[model samples]
Target: MKEEVTQNYLEKVKAQIAKLQSFSIVRIPREENIEADYLSKLAIVKEGIIPPNAPIRYLELPSIFALDVQVQAIDYSNSWTGPIVDYITNGTLPDDNVKARQLKI
Candidate 1:
């Protein structure tokens, strides 16, 4: 059912794409979009952004074991794809036997 909805949406999108002379879609990471991110942060901190009677309770935890303030995650220094790409390109394996065996499997 989800796939059918996706296919229908894609067909509509393709029809629109055909009508356009030129268009490009580029995904910007949230961290890279600092200006928009700053605006959003300001809006969230403002009191009465929503009605006081609104049942929604916003819980922003700094850490799982934390107060309302939390720090951003450090960006992936060694991303998940690093090991996989190394294994495929140069047949490199982690020094740990367990991890190398798991990768093979």
Candidate 2:
């Protein structure tokens, strides 16, 4: 019964996608879909549905371009630090004595 319901829902989604003028459907491995699955689980938690355990997997996409220019700029500007050991040894941000300013719109 559950499988039937899921199949029906997937069929409806496919039909709707077909009706769209422009779309690209990309199949990704479960490992590659972890981020989206995590967000969906977070949404479920927000809606008051608690799951048994937190998801353990993570997906990272290094090659795909992001629309956020600020993130891209930060990625380009930052120098690559070797590992967590390097960070623990040397990384430093602004101190509390320095006043932080928020950008105004």
lDDT of each candidate versus the true structure = 0.68, 0.52
For residues 9-99, write the lDDT of model 1, one tens digit per residue: 6776787699799989998887998665655565677664753333454567312323334579745339887667778878999888998
Which model scores highest in lDDT? Answer: 1
Model 2 clashing residue pairs (backbone): none
Question: Best-fitting candidate, measured by TM-score?
Answer: 1
**Which stretches of candidate 2 lie above 4 Å from their native place?**
29-32, 36-105
TM-score of 2: 0.27
Q: Summarize candidate 2's per-residue lDDT along 1-105 as a digit string, tens digits.
A: 668766766776687688799988788876788766666677657665655565644436321222333334233224443333333555533233232121110
* Model 2 local distance difference test score: 0.52
